[model samples]
Target: MPGYEAKAAQLAKMGADLIRPSGAPPFMLLGYAEERELIAGWAKKYGVQMFTSGQNHVRALRTLGIKKFVGATYFPERMNRVFARYFADAGFQVLALEGIDAPFAEVPKVPPEKILAFMKETAAKHKDAEGIYMLGSAWKTVEIIDRLEKETGLTVVHAGPARTWETQLRLGLRHPIQGYGRLLAEMPG
Candidate 1:
């Protein structure tokens, strides 16, 4: 992946929309302030929104005084749970929590039914939580999130699902998303 960055830049330029402008954005999740600036510039040029991981978006939002969010966490990792408690104690509301990938870490796979139950329990426990957030890229959360919303009657947002949504929004695609989550199999282009 050493030269992958350079290759991405080259491709961005070549595939950039000419009618839009010169400064098209490159959605990135693992970058610093400079990359944020570059993406912001490109977004302005192409009239596109800057796509970012929820973590980054949360950080940026916090720095700018936005203190509330409902986020997804994979399963129930001890450390991530600790972080969630910290955020909650810090006055940030966690609307939804998703991430049952503990099986990948040698923990038993908590079934989707259990996850939905936990959400219901947690939501009742934390009345300030507004919705549910799903975590992980390949956690098979899209369809689960949709189902969770139906059962719990709450809003659901998954990480990969959000990425798909943002991509489709940028590409101006309006397709029916039925199988997985709202935007799991649906992408912009």
Candidate 2:
């Protein structure tokens, strides 16, 4: 996260459209909703709307009517529990939780196969879950959204699609794209 501000500053200087700052579970686990305000204030200076991944996950869950979710993270079980509690506090019903104890910086090193398998296995084992949340923005997931949803019949929501869907809606663009779940294909962009 030390380098994030410099990147964000570069993006803002380029007159970019919006920002979706995310990475730390810490940014979400405590007072999760506040991340939006934190990013929105910065977006205001750039004259664009902002949506943090944590808040957008909440929004996407409500949009998809995902009451029972199987939540998984790249963090340790301890942190995953905290996230589950965060979701529960936000009114989500967590069905099952799993996690790998990888550090935040190493999250991207986790192979796509591992992430997809984790999501698929979790959804398969917990059929009652309406959604499968693969949290952590650094965790690569956008490319697997479609296949994961098709394979499991559960809505797969990730940091990328959630923010993309919400950003399109806020920007009043209705262009739908495939391979990114219903959020991207039918989010009333």
Candidate 3:
């Protein structure tokens, strides 16, 4: 809910119409009632479109040209069901959902191999797959994206990767990228 409010406020400040009283805006969010209400209020105040937040994170696949995502569920027995339902609804076949150490600030050697293996397995199953996606902001994946991509000859997209891409995509500015695996530091959206 807090995240919803914050995101709504961000959209409002960016000149998006949260209320959409008359015209359509860029996008709409679909989600929980309480969170939706808060976003609605903000959207209304800022003239932004208001709607429910979709629970299916698989929409990211459509946006990012990504297939086969691996999400970490540390010490959770029932979370997979929820993830499965959500992803299945969004038209994604779940690749792997395994537990890994959290808050990966420093590069962990062991987990990279595990992640790589999972990506490989997913790629094998889905013959037409492009690359793998790793979720979770706290996981330090930027450090490994390049090596993984080079070694596997596949794109490795991460949560943090979008920030650099956003700058280029929205502002249309290009910058030299270096030192991070195969991913150009500033991909042109």
Candidate 4:
């Protein structure tokens, strides 16, 4: 989470295709207000596109008129609670939450199946939830979102692919990816 500016610049210079910083600690530890913008600025200095964590999800939620959510996260309770505030500030109601409290290094080890289970379990608590949130980018969720939607009958929004969804709308790239979820295939674009 430290030296993300230098690290992002280094990766950009090395020809990384996109800059997707995939965790909250960098933003949480640095303080999202000023430092988050600083991180975005750093990415731009090197001609890279970045999807800052919570912002991407917020854009999707706002665009889709998703106001109620059930949250599942790989972050510890403290950090996840911080994210809850962000959701509240955006005028979304968090019906309930379930999380791992796992350390950052252990997050990726959480299987996609486990991710599905957590989301489904939390979604079950509030069938009225307008959307479901998967808050950690490190979780291997690429293969689970669509299945989770089928299993839970809720629109699942995730952290990792948030940019592509938001950018698609920004650039009017509306065709769905086919496997992820309505947010990708069927969002208003």
The model with the greater lDDT, 2 or 3, is: 2
Task: Write the residue-wise lDDT of candidate 3 on 64-137 in tens digits.
Answer: 56555544433233544454445555566566555554443433434656666655665556555465555444
User: What's the lDDT of the predicted structure labeled candidate 4?
Assistant: 0.74
> What is the per-residue lDDT of model 1 for residues 101-175, given as tens digits with 9 covering 90 to 100?
555554335566766666666656555544555444545444467777666554555555555555555567656
lDDT of 3 at 29: 21
lDDT of 2 by residue, 1-189 (tens): 436556677777887777666654546755555655566666765665556667778888989988999978877787777777778878999898788556778888888878888788878888788988878778777888898888888887788878778888877787788878878888752
Worst 10 residues of 4 by lDDT: 27-36
Model 4 misplaced regions, further than 4 Å:
1-22, 28-51, 101-103
How much does each candidate deviate from the true structure in C-alpha RMSD? 7.7, 3.4, 7.5, 3.5
**Candidate 1 least-lDDT 10 residues:** 18-27
Q: In model 1, how many backbone clashes occur?
A: 10
Q: How big is the positional error of residue 121 in model 2, measured in Å on the Cα after superposition?
A: 1.5
lDDT values for all models: 0.49, 0.76, 0.49, 0.74
Candidate number with the higher TM-score (1 or 4): 4
Quote the lDDT for 82 in model 2. Answer: 78
Q: Weakest 10 consecutive residues, lDDT, candidate 3?
A: 20-29
The TM-score, computed over Cα atoms with residue i paired to residue i, of candidate 3 is 0.55
